[model samples]
Target: MADLETLKARKGAVRRSEIPSNVLTALNRGEIETVNLVEFLAVDHAKLFRSTRSQLSLDDKSAKLIAATIKKLADVGVMQRLADTGQVFHQVLDGSEDREAVYQQLAAHPSDVLRNWAAYMDAANAKLTFAQRLKRAKPFAIDDNMGVREIAWMCVRVPAADKIVSQIEKLHPFAKHKNYLMRRFAIELSRPCGVWTKHITALKERPEIAQPLLEFCREDETKYVQDSVANWLNDASKTRPDFVETLCDRWLSETNSKHTQRIAHRALRTLRKKADA
Candidate 1:
């Protein structure tokens, strides 16, 4: 493993050339996570990816094809490309003789990027129903790596929103998950307006579409999860202030817990801002 202290002490590498060779090597070797967005953006993932294929000994014809595809995407942005890579890999795995063995390794890979691909593979599987896809993403949703946890929901959110009426209800377990990240993932999966992702248009208009999961999470004491629920309402408030104001009022009346109060307070920020303005 690379020296943790060395990585953390980094002044912050915004360009590939600025990265210390050892730290860059460690990152390419998938021995460490990127310290920040700059480091992440500076990484040229093609070499790291090829090394991973070699380490895994995926020498089949399918592997060769994927290798070529990955090479082409070396300079591409990670956000959309990673999801596509995951889907392509899944198609290859689904037809491979060693599907289970290969997939298990990928899902448990040391590289957060590869694990993210694994999350997207499940996300891109059209065969699975929306409910099943959410269930399948649980491990990644709760991944120790923040990057993997984010992708776990980002990749699945579209499918979930397409069937929001049914999908939100099926998320009972995730909304009430033991892990805060997983619970946050459940709410983020339904955010009417998410960061860097398309809005769930229906949710922007019909706040009720997300009520089930929001209700389950409203009392969450975890600030991380609470923030997501609050943000969900905040997003809705942009389009439906009355609904958000009404809900916030009701929540304040129904629960005196500070946690609930915190959520209610945060949820009404937009309205409060408007009133003050």
Candidate 2:
């Protein structure tokens, strides 16, 4: 298990001023952890990054190396920028001679953001094949930190987008994975409208293009994987309501379990809401 700091110490603060200076110092040193979504959003990533480079002993020119990403991080909203920074950190550190050592350090760090960068670095290794990239992300997909788990999927999302047809069959086996995290990763990678990441439009307009992947998880045992499958179908529902409705109907008839029932209910929520409206 990760040696997490006391979240209570970092709790109940929105702005930098609202937090104690010592707490901010601890945050910079990757000592304290963000306790919730609000604290995660409130973090000053650029400042945290400065400490990161310093601690890593990166070249002084590292700022220039990542300048373009720094600009995007500032211009974009909080969540988008956080995910973007993961990519930036990966790109900058990918070629170092000590990259493996550096990534190991980041992967084991107390700060969820730095650990997320470690996952991004592995996932963004252009040398890895699509299936290999999925394998590389296994650790972060199941990371104890909620933030690390969320960013794990976003890290590999775009590259996997183009290979949906060619590699999805290979990915199908993961739907039945003993580790629910890997199962969720398989579904999230193909989500049509995954937040703060590129969409798989093909999956949206033509839900059946990846039906084999979704079909395997229709009665997934874990609520974590079930929610991912349901959310993927819900995303498709906006564009292919007929397809979603028909598939949910079939699933209802074929499967009898609280799992499938819950999935179908949540899967049709958007369509159901529209009809009621």
Compared with the true structure, model 2 gives a TM-score of 0.82
Worst 10 residues of 2 by lDDT: 1-10
Question: Which candidate wins on lDDT?
Answer: 1
Q: What is the TM-score of each candidate against the true structure?
A: 0.90, 0.82
User: What are the clashing pairs of model 1?
Assistant: none
Error of 2 at 23 (Å): 4.1
TM-score for candidate 1: 0.90
Q: On residues 38-93, what C-alpha lDDT tens digit does candidate 1 reach at each position? A: 66765556777766776563657778877777778876777867877887788877
* Candidate 2 lDDT over residue span 216-241, tens digit each: 88888898888998999999999999
| Candidate 2 error regions (>4 Å) | 1-5, 8-23, 50-76, 79-94
- Backbone clashes in each candidate structure, one number apiece? 0, 0
Best by TM-score: 1
C-alpha root-mean-square deviation, each candidate: 2.4, 3.5
